[model samples]
Target: MRKCLSALLAALAFIPGCAPEGTGDLDVQWTVGLTGSCAQANLGFVAARLETLSGTLLARRDAPCDAHAVRFRDLPVGSYRVRLSAFDGDGVEAYAATVSDLSVQEGIEAASCLARLTPRPGTISLSWYFQGGRLCSAYGVEDVLLSLFSADIEILAQSFRCDRGAAVLEGLLPGSYEVRLDAVDAWGVPSHSFAAGNLLLRPGHELSFDAELTPCQGPCW
Candidate 1:
């Protein structure tokens, strides 16, 4: 799903006192970059991480998407960075930002800000046809199942009517994927198949795949 945009500007501030010995406290507030709200962009939550200046992770948490301020209490005094990421309903990152060079002092409150996250994700549109025709009647096929594989693991599976011939997948991570298509007959038997390997997906772009499915000879017969 493609969404519209709204700019969210984050702010940074620091206050003195109210911390335990040899430690500090942190508070973070942020909002989604695009659309009216996170819900409008189909984003559920924000992934927040506290890390050292040298890339050592300190603490991480998931915050609400509604611009709620999250509290990180009792942090060791040090210099660190804060990273924020918001994900879509399917756990795909839809918004992200990294803020660095934060210095936390003992017995003080560190307030942080974040840069605007660009809404960037990929989409895949697939269309399939049988050797005989586009109608799928000649092959007795009633359904086509589409499965997407990432790193040799099945990430998604969806079924569509054979006659439909096309479907669109959205909010995909940028990477290499394998697309598998199976045509099933009236009795739920697989009658034809097609596969395309190493399909590349880029950020903020749409990839299209059109393929012809051959009859399952020895296996189906």
Candidate 2:
């Protein structure tokens, strides 16, 4: 069965082209496979865009999730970039991936141009340190609570028990956020709080910061 299928595919790849003789036919055929968590999410649809290196749009397609793949056929042999975006039921972009510098050659099908989509989200890596004072003496900071707030100070996401003086907050949408860090003592009492404002996060990027919590004479909130 495998040998027969392989022979059939080889024969189909040589369909005659409109181009005159001596010019030869180097038509490109490509396929994008959906893998990883994005595939497991069972998104409603997957969209793709093909563009030239100079940013000129070449082609676009939208395929149903059940198709399990997207195929582009009869393309001119050239260098191009293909970007894939997967959308959920609510039409929100859930995952994205890009395959660039694709060089389509004669008699060679670009069937392995697989785009492994990852969840469309940003991450925050923070390193926290405690400065000296009476607050440090009275309390042994055991864990840290990191909170992400919107422009209006509404809580968007929070991470707890961020230990080892370092933590990573993942799966955040692209936007501006305000971060609040609170130190929790061994007794579970909040000791000090620090605020970092106006952090911009974008997809496929990691935002990092180093926070130093100083001793406060009065309440830090």
Candidate 3:
């Protein structure tokens, strides 16, 4: 009886780390370049799981330009397929782009950034290929939340369930500001932080920052 109880306790002790088996650290970053020019556009990064694709949505929520690039980090260990879309400045639906055979392993940085250009402004959209590293029936996260703030720590805008993997902050007063992304886990723990340094933007022109959130707990974990 003592040995049986010991074994049972041991299994329970490992369940938190082993059960569900979907917990891990993931970080991503990206940048976009204007057409026909070397000038680059920046997109923020995010920390998410393979299941966060369900609520992935895109809107022509910014300005002109079409070319964009994205990067993923600390993803789960599995394969993935990425889907993309193009939108005009008016938020009109366009076409789709797909990438297959993408894989993510533990402890390795996955170069999941998608970079492509189209002639329309509102034609850009995004989605992922993996089912949260699990072949189970359900999909993971629907949409990740993004909060944009100025240097003064003022909230410019809060985008919820933003599918585009990018936000076009237009109508700004044209100045320098700081950007950060917030990442949450299944237990509602905010562990990652992605920040962009002094970004300069013009009133009419748009600026994008791909804030990639990674798994970063405090020293104690």
Candidate 4:
């Protein structure tokens, strides 16, 4: 019993945020370098820092003296930070920061722009970070019930767990619907909810929505 309980606790630690194998990879590696003239500049060198939106620092390295590169790898799919800096004899720090949205694909050598994630027809997918901050999955979240309502706030379908974070809400009357998501987090705690969009669910086609979550607050109401 003790061994079983320990195993259960280990699994719980990896809930919602960590998806199982075969889901996909979110690893990316790229180089950052300095351009233009470095000599005329106040400092002879620059530095770089890669971080997540949650303020997690992924990697950091010194900027190349010339047109050089810094490589970053194994980043999760989502948002991140890129900071640049230079130093002088005074030891006073100077830096710049930028945000980057990254998507990882297996065997792809280069990064694509964020505009590419738009959903297409036939296999509508809706994804979000669940209770424990893990990706919602087919095996785990496929069992929760769903109820879609129209833009008029009228009920459409009653409720059923749409497998694989992608639902084919078939037999529709052809109109827009307000999408709401309710689920449990990685820890099996009831999820905080969200709306996909004021979406136009067209007939005979698939619609995809990436419904991410935000911290619950009275202001959200």
Candidate 5:
């Protein structure tokens, strides 16, 4: 009888005394824009990861970018970190952003998370000139229209009223670009045209180019 009682006591000790507290829910939404020049159709997935304050991963959820939201349920009440990422159709990460010190409470929902992401950028400085002095001196070609294009012929950036014979294009992604400039007369009509192509820009790098315009005798098309 004594041996049986001791064995029963040992077995009861191994069992848990009480159930764990109920978990909470975490809802996250990205309020900011994504990085890269890819189209939305190329974006394959959006992912969110929850981790403890000490960097212990707790849960992860992935959904389509068009799903509009992400939720992690049954999370213990504590502080955590959330990371968000957008992946392309080829499984390549196009953009990533994170939020820290998120608090979750028992039986309560924690929402209102916002993450902002920015792509790597480069710079382009362009200066314009005319082959004949008549375009600038006689016609007074002070206002110019400038357009920047990607290698695939996509319009990446543009500017109007570019004065001082110079224009600066900023926050451009690293790639090959082409420059197109049109001189505007007092009546806002295009009088001259110039083009510079195959300019390479790297991340955090600056590129400078010169555009020499020729007078349009007939119609500036």
Candidate 6:
């Protein structure tokens, strides 16, 4: 019957619409900052990726570390997140950076110029509480302020929920630093605090510790 044949033709024509057509390219560039040059940092290769805003992988390409750049061809036209990662000879990821809201248009090359990639992140997992047998929740503690200092200069700071029990920080540069913790209340005030010296972090590594905060009593800002 002609009607059945026509229906089959119509279904065949609609099949291509199921997938996005590739009509774009991307050029991603970066410098190794947290550890200096690729050779100095012992990086051997780099990998680039284009992902959707929701973190869906679209395309990936690998290049020599020193290339300092990678191009992605035949990408779909849409907003994407660009990520560049570098690895050492031992296959450990040593540096990385991500740029979001990068728009890839049809038939033109889009450039992402992130000045430098950070050294492979080191992680610090902290389990915290007050010294005088007080749990974070029982004492009206709302947030925990964890900060890192090198040579008495503040390096990084992050806030975690008090009741979260434990928090992991994966944004530290490889170095020895001091660690500080503050138990803060609903009014952005610290009522208990603790500090320790000689916290060491290394690239592609993790450190874990417990913190006991003594009552600051007053003016513990």
Give all TM-scores, in the order shown.
0.49, 0.46, 0.32, 0.33, 0.44, 0.52
Lowest-lDDT window of 10 residues in candidate 1? 1-10
Model 1, 8-40: lDDT tens digits are: 101111333432237767777776564447777
lDDT of 1: 0.75
lDDT of 6 by residue, 139-169 (tens): 8799989888898999788898888767787
- Of 1 and 5, the candidate ranking higher by TM-score: 1
The candidate scoring highest on TM-score is 6
Candidate 5 CA-lDDT value: 0.68
Each candidate's number of clashing pairs is 1, 0, 33, 11, 0, 0
lDDT per residue as tens, model 4, 83-171 = 55544334433223343544332344644321111112222345655545554463244333345676557474334343354455554
> Which residue runs does candidate 1 get wrong by more than 4 Å?
1-119
Model 4 off-target regions past 4 Å? 1-35, 112-221
What are the RMSD figures for all models against the true structure? 14.0, 11.9, 25.0, 22.0, 14.8, 10.1
| Candidate 1 to truth, TM | 0.49
**Which candidate has the highest lDDT of all?**
6
Model 4: ten consecutive residues of lowest lDDT: 114-123
TM-score computed on alpha carbons, candidate 3: 0.32
**How would you encode candidate 5's per-residue C-alpha lDDT over 1-221 as one tens digit per residue?**
53454345445545697323456788887633544333532556778888865687888899877665798887754556888877766575555678887755576546457666333476898787777543364666657877778865757545455457787788778678888778887777888888778898754467887778887879876
**All candidates' lDDT scores?**
0.75, 0.64, 0.39, 0.46, 0.68, 0.77
87 Cα displacement, candidate 6 (Å): 1.9
Candidate 1: C-alpha RMSD to true structure equals 14.0
* Native-referenced Cα lDDT, model 6: 0.77
